[model samples]
Target: MDCVDLTTVLAGITLRNPVVTCSGTYGFGEEYADYCPLEALGGITLKGITPLPRLGNSVPRLAETPAGLLNSVGLENPGLEDFLVSYLPKVRKMPTAVIANISGFSLEDYVQMARALQVDSGLAALEVNISCPNVKHGGMHFGTDPHSAEEVIAAVKAVTNLPTIAKLSPNVTDIVEMARAAQRGGADALSLINTLLGMRIDIEQQRPLLANTFGGLSGPAIRPVAVRMVWQVAEAVDLPIIGMGGITTWQDAVEFLLAGATAISIGTGNFVNPQAPLEIIQGIKGYCEKHGLTSVRNLVGLAHKG
Candidate 1:
């Protein structure tokens, strides 16, 4: 315990630890402040923001599965200006590292937001969410197509001084190809396993459950898939990995770290228990101490040794 070090430096951003909260689930980093103090975790990814404020999809945007939550929130958020003027002030002062998540409809839309958030904004990194699956003609196009992924990432990296992390969608046919594409685009790091595209049926109504008809599926159900993708990407891509999908417990976090994730993010888990990050952090430390490891970073990609 005395010698263990939890510090994690990913994509040039320093974090006290490697347990971060996911965007959308964590809100603007203020909503969960009461339940999970910012100082207790590594960082918080602000909700996905677009160029213009969105009303989002119509009602019935959420559905529940046995072990997952499907949501069609449509990246609803205040426009970039509101986030900069109203949110960035407080976000810059948060106790832990802060990462901004951005989504857009077109290449230019992404470029517009990246130009605004730079080093002066006090952001540790920029998570380009090219994988958002809910909205019609959203950023998923950039996420699924390798060439487009490369182009969008390179475009964002060109304008923003913040380290760029391309959040990849799991809906792709070849995850490794996407990772390679992101690397070519100059992404400093990769956040893999964004929600899988899925939908549900309203048996009672005899129609699709959600008004949007489809949503991003996330939770414990996606953990295995996330880990598989992280392992696959880590094996081929040189970029550090921010593994996330359905990390709810300490063991789930450890699995991701072993699979090659430099850091792990909790999304729907936060909804179930806001204190999850704290518990998982402690659990990782205890695991490291018991194993006689001096740094948590040593856990990343350990499984690959075999």
Candidate 2:
């Protein structure tokens, strides 16, 4: 197994493996430092941060579904200034790459956040989260519209030298269009299929389950949709993709890689098992060994070979 290389390159950045912790689920990478060795994973995408601090949504922000979880966290974070002053330094010391996820209400907000991150020498890349369904004015609004998504990506790219990844939404009408838009806007990579918009009804109370009335749906139920979107986007664009949505096992991650994702991220799976990423990392290595493969990169888009 030592001969099998799990290392892969994304947007010119080298990753020890392809398993990255999805933003918003892994907190700021510090919460899980004790639970799991942060250095063992490929990368950690810090929780979505904004130019200004956000308190997030009200109570009843989370609901559990049959095979999935619904969350309306509303991009809660300590804001860019505090993160740079306090968290970035600690994140820099970690062995894995630190990818910052940024969300915004306006084009300027994205630009401002990108500019601030430019001076952070510890940062690896910027994941522009335009697909947050929890927010009202921005978030999914920009992601659903191709033109708006392009505008935000272009604006951020103009302000930062760091590699930029445009995270796309599954709630859109045509995921491929959005992917192409992001590529044209100068995104170095793309992360597909942010949680699908969903809602739950409290039958007894006859009201919405979440206080926000709606939230993003994630878990095994959305895996098929996520893979489909990743494959579609991969075929449509030339940029590297970080595919995520309901990936709970190495098999699931491998399915995404075959579907055309250059790498994969663990989201809801993290909540179910803190060691999920590490386990998946080992699983991928084991799988490569079993298949007589020398590198995990060889598995990307293998399903398209036929």
Error of 2 at 190 (Å): 0.5
Off by over 4 Å in 1: none
Candidate 1: C-alpha lDDT: 0.94
Pairs with backbone N, CA or C atoms under 3 Å apart (clashes), candidate 2: none
lDDT of 1 by residue, 1-306 (tens): 567799998998888999999989998898998898899889889999999999899889999998999999998999999998999999889998899999999999999999999989988999999999988886899999999999999999999899999999999999999999999999999998899989999899999999999999999999999999999999998889999999999999999999999999999999998899999999999999998889999999999997
Cα lDDT computed for each candidate against the true fold: 0.94, 0.92
Alpha-carbon RMSD to native, per candidate: 0.7, 1.0
Candidate 2 accuracy as lDDT? 0.92
Best by TM-score: 1
Model 2: residues with Cα > 4 Å off, grouped in runs: none
